[model samples]
Target: MRTQQFSRTARSLVAAACALTCLAAEAAAIKIQSRDPAGFGFNDPTPAAPVGGNTGTTLGEQRMNVYRYVADIWEKNLDSDVEIVVSAGWEPLACTATSATLGSAAAWNVWRDFENGKPGTWYPQALANKLAGENLSNGQPDDGTGYGNVDIKTQFNINLGQPNCLAGSGFYLGLDGNAGDAVNFAATLLHELGHGLGFSVVSVQTSTGYRLNASATAYSPTGLPSIWEGFMYDNTARKSWLEMTATERRQSAINPLQLAWTGPNAVAGAAITLAPLPVVKATSPAGAVPTTPYTASSFGPAVPRSGKLGVLATITAQAGELGPGCSPFDAANAAAVRGKVPIINRGGCTFAEKVKNAQNAGAVGVVLANNVAGSFAPGGADPTVTIPSVGVLQEDGERLKAAVAAAKAYGSRTQPGAVTASFAIDPNRKAGADLAGRPLLYTPNPLIGGSSVSHWDVSAVPNLLMEPNISDDLTLSVSPPKDLTLPLLKDLGW
Candidate 1:
């Protein structure tokens, strides 16, 4: 995290260029180089007509679509009036040239090798050379050009990899429609481009000063200290503008680091649509004798003593600390006494096994909490399991455990006992409903109806290996947008 400032010599050079350019009256140009190889899948067949329909859209078109999506968000949210100029061909040049070397496969390969081994290592000389190839900027061998430029390069590469692009960042996007498909291109691109647009700021914080590194910046978006994390954890504090509190003010503020793009009165733009979760209905007999006594301390108030409550019974198997084998008359029995909610510890077997066990015993609902210390944020329930279940924290589990202990200490005198409990389920709880209508928003779970976060939820993993529950997978990581702001509307003439 070394902070490298622009050198005096570079400043002098820029001054000289400005003086010379004044006489020529030349405008500084923002160039976009679109590299489309012949016969590549991204090329449009007609070239003249707008690319539409499934077949006519090429790989490049998909990538462009993603860019448009991002641009739309930036314009509506950030109010940036910048114009984008797109150029497509074999190779297009943009700026200053500092290196003498032309194109060389060996050079590209060597650079790739160095980059792959350690993604974060910054080589000023190599970067200056690479920039020379693109004519973006100029630098000397020992001048310490730094990574601000490298951040831009990494962003460009990510854009190229659009759909089936490469895993990390090295693999170039292929026009071969066979390798990369257009599925999820819009969301994935928006997420990655977010990295390109100053989302990396959260990674380097200061006790006193800023931490700097090109890789740190490049890796920032998909990494943590994410805007989403900040908003979720700091909801009450208003520390992040992305939360509901700052939603209106975000649009007027120009700073990219602020949470919301506009203030509370501003529109949140289109809401991010999500898929729906699967529905599971309760199915069990309607009446059974109480295996345990009913009490408010033993079960929640929602549980009923008769009807759907007592008729349903669920059986489960507990292993590890609770000991192994199935328990037919344990937690499920407690739930049946009141007719609807059963609590179980999470360990020993798969969620499917636990659900099947409960189903066999005729229970209608299940609540499973972590057996370990801390919160029960272990992950999600198995998607295939049909029973509706939610997780409780370890503290809740401990409360039940303590009640059981007290019941044993009291002997059999206590009717229904302190350990009595019931099962309860809700069929219509929607995911992300907490912040669904707000300007700044996020989904806590990946699958709409499923219980966990999917690999595709974030933009860092290899596109090919993405799957549901990838958030729990150690291989994947998430990068969140940092403080994002839009300048005062008047400044941008809107």
Candidate 2:
């Protein structure tokens, strides 16, 4: 829930293009058409036309150019034939949503059938209407496969409670990165368009996710009812799409920070990465600094040791926490661990599993002292978790564990302990650990709207463009740092 401030400087850079053209020779090129929502007052900014996503303050041609830029990035890289209709307009910002939001999007008449020989797929109906670019004159070809025929619709935000449409906020809407307190419009466009391409889940989830909404005349490769619920993956439940129960699927969307995208295109796109150097630190309750252990959480925002941090108490007993190496860590222990970092032993399960349990139980951050040896990078693959987590050295872990045991014998969730400490980000560390040379998406325990089960997770070397909220320092290019949105488009059956 931390809001990005206005400070970073923008670096002028061209969107590094990618090899995203559709595979089939007959596949029509991706057509991106922009429109002003009918009857809605929409004003173009200043600076008119430009070369990339950012267009300064100028509206009209400039803003449209940025929209075209986003379309160009996707159109050129995606291997599909379909039209995306975009609607730009102004709307009141809800007190609950991000004020900087540029807009929102949704796929129209959507349906899915395995395209790359995979199961539980979701594709636009317009794309599924034809094969490659083959003629659809004979009643708009019905041979199920590839992209569809109808156009996908989207709405962009021209006003976030602002009167003068061109008045700049702490956001840069040009081809450049954040320029003296500005958000990149190009990058924002990319994120919103990605959602329209089916990077979103149902806000009100049902047993089968939201209905496919495709007409009876629409394509349904599986004859089964189509829904966004059919494409989700729950690691904690180890269930993919239809395999999950209604509850599991709904929970997946709620805790997006910990979920994974199984769509071939999403997985493939997620294969992308950027160089990372996040500065995060976790000192023990005793004030002693631990070893070089670090983490790349896909959930909570990264903070520097030089900045403000979460709880620093030594973890004694937990509440509702469970796992092989876990003990009485649950709600009953909230009084002792509330708002404090809980130190827990590792092993018997994944690093993510332990943190998820601890975080959901009300722990702000978790210091997972390794049950085994040398420091290794920590990981996050679920949505329920939203706290900072780290893997301290074995010795360091034991020190915290010992301190807890001495203060309050036998990990009892109800007993308070004398373990009082603090934590901070490792300013010297700079960035986070490079995640296995690939980007991972975050699926939290309880999902965050719009951000649930989408975007690159913490493992990415440097923060990527599609990581929930776009980073100000992000570039205008379609390169990894500036362009993960297209890669995901490529993954979602392009």
Candidate 3:
């Protein structure tokens, strides 16, 4: 989807030095053990050891802060009540400490393995054993038992050595080189923890030894079988549930899900949802001579002159063509409502420009159809453009074009200079109405009230990278242990 990039105001604050030891009690909530005895590592500590004869700022405390923040966000989002333990001693089992003598290239290689592919041949087994030991000791499932005993590990190889990583991760946030930017360490940690809590790619073994995978799915612990099973079957059906969870979490942070514009920290009011443009149908015979003129009301649903629905309008355009609203008004079709909806050829200019031109022409809505054979881009609408819009298949546009040509040959001359077209709106389309500048309201829920949890402030660490737009980027994997009843499957068919 095309998203509008907007500049946001920057906020700054001087970070007060506080002893890391002071947070030890809080860290215990996440099962994180602190190496700093006096918490001096954060507030005041001995000078760091020199690297290449240069000393770098100690990041131990900042790293711990990130852990705390992640735990807090997770606690807030999860439906179940569970305690999260963030510990410094829990070394990333997937990564190995590199020797000081290794060059940057070698260090990067070590990091790259963690991000793209599975762990080394020895690592998974060893890690599984370690986790099994921990679980068994805690009276949980041991290795080769239930799915819960399985340890699935994936790496996020963020390049901390690069400035982009720092900026993207929101670690080195402010102009003064201080922390506390809106996209701060805490936010990054929250995102990463999202991955840890079943928000990454997942697969399940099937009875036929095949695997089913869906690019996107919802998160559900109940759907997933125990980890002890080997080899996923029918993986094609797997969906990324993690992505949905992340989106919900991010939305919750920025705005309330129930109330569109009522987010505690929303930058704008509730957004408007516009409908798709009406299509024009042909009324004449094929290959007939042009004899009629197009009129403004020839298309589907007349533009509402008043009332709530009147606040929005839609105009369809040919695939890879300019939208009806964006196309320049054609004098040859003077009576035609060309400017009302500019239907230019598609697949050239960006959707942003198309929507911009339509908005410029006093159009409140626009639609772009595909010119070629392909699915519309997911989330195709530009995020920056608040106006409601959608895309149609190229075949559908061609059919409409044929209908218009037939109408012209039928001598249905309403006007020589007028343009008229109409098409039906799909009844099953997702329902959303446009209401700009409106307030969204929701009732209070007594079952779950407001509460706060640990908040960690993360910092850049050497050779690690954090995912961007954590809200929508993460994905989850889930599968049923056995074939579900046909009735159940049909009832939940998506």
Among these predicted structures, which one has the highest lDDT?
2
Q: Which ten residues in a row have the lowest lDDT in candidate 2?
A: 1-10
> Which lDDT value does model 2 have at 73?
66
Local lDDT at 452 for model 1: 18
TM-score of every model versus the real structure? 0.38, 0.54, 0.34
Q: Residue 173, candidate 1: how far off, in angstroms? A: 15
On TM-score, the candidate that comes out on top is 2
> lDDT, candidate 1, residue 149?
29
lDDT of each: 0.29, 0.48, 0.27
lDDT of 2 by residue, 20-51 (tens): 33322333355554445543423444444443
RMSD per candidate (Å) reads: 16.1, 13.3, 19.2
Top-down TM-score ranking: 2, 1, 3
What global local distance difference test value does model 2 have?
Answer: 0.48
